[model samples]
Target: MECKNDYLCEKQINMDKLFEYSNRLIKETDTKFFRYMYDEINWKNRMIGLIGPRGVGKTTLVLQYIKQNLNPSETLYVTAEDFYFVDNRFTDLADTFVKYGGKYLFIDEIHYPNLNKIQTFPYNSLINSYSLSCQF
Candidate 1:
């Protein structure tokens, strides 16, 4: 029981930090310059994949949408390269995020994570059941 409590406490702490980082990024984004495809891509879609060259504002576009639209607490923005991935699986993060009431998950640089982990059963099962709007 004590060990489980400690794990839960640690998870909450990590989530708090993740949300803080996400909010900071959203706050810093200026929606003034909208990307060309921003409007074309339907935000209503469950999974939105933005493919483009580097420095083309893919991350900025999603940040703008999250800032202008979604509730901060319900949405989480994480990059595949985030330090959390070092000790955690992507599916585990997704599961915990959902448990904490996360509705939208924006994983920038999605290609950076291990493809096998992202394609595993638990991850697929989570997305199928949850209202996840993943942006890669």
Candidate 2:
């Protein structure tokens, strides 16, 4: 996808060749769930919050939607538990990512306490975090 800031953006490298092979069963099952949610969601201009007990497949549902609808290059999947996140600032990563054309960010385990303080990061990037947390 083309971005306004060419200097900040670079070509996306699809390192995971696995994305090419369409898994019929996974797609079908994910689609069924997406369809159900689609019927329930008004995606036009609303934020969606998916909450449930652990291991109930909430993350699976988000990943499935991103896989089916968006190019992998335009998205970034991150988890608060990631080692890199321990010492890294979410705002810094988000600024670098968005300034480079990132569109969707799928963050898991965001209920972590570290992220709670990130809502006060002095940057536009924290807006998404706050919005997302509020939605949650």
Candidate 3:
């Protein structure tokens, strides 16, 4: 099913634009910091967490990994604070994203309410619920 709200559509489109922009940002930046985390982190895991104070390069690392490791066509990167999600539910978004062949969901700002809640649910809930590898 598709969203009834047109604003959500526009926002989602912009979100896609953001992902493209993110890809360019990753490509343009100097990511030497990626050497340690890129090689060290087990990207094969179903769920991975990066915790640190603000201004750290966590988002850059995830975007770089997505750019280098995953299929850009099948992956999605959404920041939790997007106003689009205020009306568009995360569960519904996940349903639609996976329904459309979305494989990797890289969510930034996971400490936000919606994502933090997902973290509390059973591990299999995400993996089993949506055949998608989610990283926060």
Candidate 4:
């Protein structure tokens, strides 16, 4: 099923662009260099958040997992700092992705979005509504 909303289509385009960027990064990432936390993280969880200082390899870990485990068509990797978020809402991206059958959404740099603007139920409701698994 495809969305008819032009705005959502625009968001889908942004998502495709992000996927292209993420694929390049994932291709460059060396899976042999595994982090301790990578083994510690339970990839089966509905939602996961990795919090730590910069250069901690969190993004690389997620990218590696996507490369090794998840199917590309079922997953999406996006960053909060991406220009797409400047005009589009995160929820809108989630909605469009799910509509098109995305299952796992990995968001890098999760802290960049304004918590106040995102408001309540954005996370919990999103999971309940779409059954989308997110990693940050």
Candidate 5:
């Protein structure tokens, strides 16, 4: 199932444009670091938690994986800090992503205050590949 073009807009991001940004980001981030995460990640029935200090490029690594391995239509990349999230529930967004055939979900800032509430329910209830990370 392909994601509707409007879904990106609803997220306040242009999917095509974000893909282009991702391409450029691929060249900018450390290839070695991304390769390490790629090799380490189980990618099947696994939850990954990346904990590191700020500016250590954890978010970049996640974006690099999405940019390299999956089509934008098949993924949803979101940061908890985004204002849209104030009104939109994380579960709702996950549900939408699953309905539109999203396979991989990359969520940044998992250590944020309300994250525990979001993680209380089983992510498999919405989609698979529920990979999360935070800057510690």
Candidate 6:
């Protein structure tokens, strides 16, 4: 279901749950290892990837950045495996986020089902957030 009133984009996104989750993670101090990379990352770059075995602070690093610099209005963070992705396509979500003037998007665990759908998305639309910036 889509939001009826567009200005209050609040209705479009699950802001309440998102804030609760984001706040919980942001309160903790940054991790000792790998956390340093967060600051070093060129968030402005169009694409970034973190490849490693599990247990690293990759997710935490991104979440910390979101909590530190971005508010719900400017950024959106979601895992590829999230239920929200089941019914909705990522590109569609990007469109809606752009419509509401979103600036950042963070997607974790990108190796989810239907990875090919991303290939179908228009290349430009992929980072419609050209002005939007986020680190992976």
In lDDT terms, which candidate is top?
Answer: 1
Candidate with better lDDT, 2 vs 5 = 5
Residue-wise C-alpha lDDT for candidate 3, range 1-136, written one tens digit per residue: 3556996676567556756755666567565556576688788887666666555777777777876777776777777666646776566556556755777776566454244446533243432111123742
Give the best candidate by TM-score.
1
Q: For every candidate structure, what is the RMSD over all alpha carbons to the true structure, in angstroms?
A: 5.1, 7.1, 5.7, 5.1, 6.4, 5.9
TM-score of each: 0.81, 0.56, 0.66, 0.78, 0.60, 0.64
> What is the lDDT for 49 in model 1?
64
lDDT of candidate 5 over 28-81, digit per residue (tens): 656455546666765554446666666776777787776666666666667666
Candidate 1's TM-score reads 0.81
Q: Any residue pairs clashing in model 4, and if so which?
A: none
Winner by lDDT between candidate 6 and candidate 1: 1
After superposing candidate 5 on the true structure, give the runs of residues whose Cα lies further than 4 Å from its correct spot.
1-35, 113-120, 124-136
User: Who is ahead in TM-score, 2 or 6?
Assistant: 6
Candidate 6 root-mean-square deviation in Å: 5.9
- The Cα error of candidate 6 at residue 7, in Å, is 16
Backbone Cα, N, C clashes tallied per candidate: 0, 0, 0, 0, 0, 1
Indicate the worst ten consecutive residues by lDDT in candidate 2: 127-136
**Cα lDDT, all candidates:** 0.74, 0.47, 0.61, 0.70, 0.56, 0.57
Off by over 4 Å in 2: 1-35, 44-47, 113-118, 121-136
- The C-alpha local distance difference test score for the whole of candidate 5 amounts to 0.56
lDDT tens per residue, model 6, 6-123:
7445536654455445456655637444566777987666545554545676777776766666775667666666666776676765676566576676666665333434575434
Off by over 4 Å in 4: 1-9, 112-122, 125-136
Residue pairs in clash, model 6: 129-132
Q: lDDT tens digits, residues 1-136, model 1?
A: 1226878888888888899999999999998888778789799877766665667778888899999999998899987677988888777788888888788888776553334345652434232111234632
